[model samples]
Target: MNKIVQIDPDQVEDVGPLYAARKKVYPQKVSGTFRRIKWGLMAFCLGIYYFLPFVRWNRGLAAPDQAVLIDLPNSRFYFFFIELWPQEVYYFTGLLILAAITLFLMNSVGGRIWCGYLCPQTVWTDLFYAVERLVEGDRRERMKKDASAHRWTLERISEFVLKHSIWLMIAWWTGGAWVLYFTDAPTLVKELVTFQAPAIAYIWIAILTATTYLLAGFMREQVCVYMCPWPRIQAALTDEWALNVTYRYDRGEKRMSVKKANDLRALGQHAGDCVDCYQCVAVCPVGIDIRNGPQLDCIQCGLCIDACDNVMKKINRPTRLIGYDNDINIQRRIEGKAPIYRIVRPRTIIYAALIALVGGIMLYTLATRSLLDINVLHDRNPVAVKLSDGSIRNAYTVRFLNKRGFDRVVAIDIDGPQDAKLHVVGGDSITPDRPMIVLGRDGTTELRVLVTAPSDRNPEKSIPVKFRVTDIGLGEVASATDNFVAP
Candidate 1:
């Protein structure tokens, strides 16, 4: 007994414009516990990024000596003592999964901690802001200079030039450091200085430099507010218990001047501790009023908390009017109850367990993975040929990888078609009775091979064939399966 409902598609109107113009945010600077933490983290992150490529590891003479490198030319990735082959790309997949789960776990306990603290965008933007503050002055002075019409004095012009020059230098270094991960850092540096590096290297550096300059210098908060999808995702993933930078309206309502609040308290009337100062908003990188409750524009950076706490201290009142808080805590405060924290909840536990499980699996696989590998592909045309000696012959392309540091002699054998003999097409060193070839150190070799079986012992149609390759020096064996066909 349901009524049918129909509407014309054209009848619906578009609600509103999909986008809005951006407002520039000139964030004021503040200092406190969070600021100090930010400074330390920024230094650590930038130091590792810029200097780690130069750190050498003793990886013998033949291999790259850098601690970490992606040798695209050789199709290898070297990380300290560990080396990865092209077939082992799944390790990167596992690492990506671990990183995602770790981010989720971090979010379940502390909302947007990645965005507020560790995100590359935030770190670079913070560095750029530090440079800007150093050259142009603090928030108020910068704002005043921008607002005045006749402010472009020689000193201002000089500051502008200096600030931009420094920013460009930092950006160039950032790009330059990235290229070091692909080659010998010292060698590449020498080549780059002498204009002898490859054109592609220069192209990549230029692209990265432009992006870093634009995104960190000009886009800044705009990238956090409008461009990034993490804020939206974090909002969806957050629970009531996830601590975020919050303004406690319970203690901040009925905001007034300090004298007015004191007079009201003396008269036995309620007056909020907030002095209606806009310091919190002023220092916010996104220029959001945290007092207006949770908003997507708020990055939970904790700068407002520092600004509000400083203001509260100046007024001789209780601090932490703004702090790392949650909705449940806010509600508890409203009901005159102590706030509770539940960091070990179901979601957090699940995320942590997933991270641990994936990490353990990856470690186990890496520890026991085979260093020798083989692959076989049957010939496409004339898969089987009748030999003049009344024998059935089949051609194959065999590829083998030697993942060890030294050379290896691998003996190849076939396990199908009775009385079958193996032969390498152009290898003079391989014996007709027991075919073997030398595999180079840490490389792959492809060779054409043939298998012949007597007509009396040949299979009728197609039969499963197993190609086994045994390393004579290391006693390691690898096998691959293909099909043997008879004409």
Candidate 2:
């Protein structure tokens, strides 16, 4: 049996509405180990992003001098000495697989480490927050200024202008740097400075600049909390053994003032280490309280850990009130057992093995990839024609690609039918069976080819024909297959 008491909308009104306005958070800065790590990672990531385009790679005189390029106009991708054609898009597939497995490995060891530290959104937002703090002061002062008339003063306005100008400059530079990766960096730089760069380049720069500015400068934490899907996906992927930035309530509960706790200890009464300082809450970039456990809103930035550690040091208590600890260790500590970490568990091992295996295959294939290729398309409409001399004729369209930087002499050959003679409509066959052609480096040649065979040996429906392309100088080879049809 169930019981229903009463309906009372007015009664709940005195207790206030279900929802209330959210309070803005102003995070204070603290220097600690995690803070230092964030700084180092930020430098490495930003340095690579901003300056890597200037790095050079040599591909001899036949290729673009730039070390890295996307060469969209030419339908090629160049990475230093390595060049990839459209047919090799499978390399991107292998790379994506490696990336996914790497993410899994990272999550197996530490939950959402990518989200907290390395994600573009997080990194950019962290940088923006640093700028904000420098211009507006830390938590308390910023809050006071926001609540007071001082927010509109000339000094504050000047700071706002200076900060945004710098932000726009960084955003523009980021967009400009992206364009360099698509073309010769030195040449692009010269063209861009002279306002003679392609119109598409300017258009892309403007779009990226606006997006970066709005996302990092204004949208900020909103992107992490509501826009990205990784938080939810990572939550599902994480295990209980994974180390996450967490508040150790076992050591930090039953909050009280430091003086009260000291007096309590003197009286032989048990007391927690926390002084209820709210330092952890104050330093959060996404404005989540660590004491509440793992919530989606928490970016796991470790600022809270640093804040709590600072408090612990000042109060002469043990540190790591908030630290990277797993639930298994937390439970073990509660049960009076020493905590243990297992970073090399079965899942981590499997992820590592798969990454190494796939990466090795990709590397090997890339190193030994051939520089020439061919494709053949048999005429589908007519299929085959009856020759006047009691022979069968088949037509084919053949395409030859020479990936080298200069022109090359190539010989084409076909083998399938006996007494079949090959002829290129506007080209030449070296022998009655082999066709010789010239292919331009980094270019393609198309030929209309005809094959005639004595009707006796030809198969009734279709028979396989292999078109082989042989590079004369390098002895490199590529081939494609099609079928010769007969009525």
Task: Give the number of the best model, judged by TM-score.
Answer: 1
lDDT of 2 by residue, 1-487 (tens): 8998997876675766676445566778888988898888998998888888888877766678777789998999987777888999999999899999999889889888888889988787788778889888888877888899657899889888988988888889889899889888888889999999999999999998899999888877778877898888889988888899988888887789999999999999978898888888888887888898989988787888899999999999999988999878888888999999998888888999999999999999988888798889889888899988789999999888888888888887777888788889987555545677778778888899898888888756778888888888889889988887786
Candidate 2 to native Cα RMSD, angstroms: 3.7
Segments of candidate 1 deviating more than 4 angstroms: 1-19, 428-432
Count of backbone collisions within predicted model 1: 0
Compared with the true structure, model 2 gives a TM-score of 0.92
- lDDT (10s digit) by residue, model 1, range 16-38: 77887777777889999888888
Against the reference, the lDDT scores of all candidates come to 0.90, 0.85
> Least accurate stretch of 10 residues (summed lDDT) in model 2?
16-25
Clashing pairs in 1: none
Candidate with the greatest lDDT versus the true structure? 1
Error of model 2, residue 244, in angstroms = 0.3
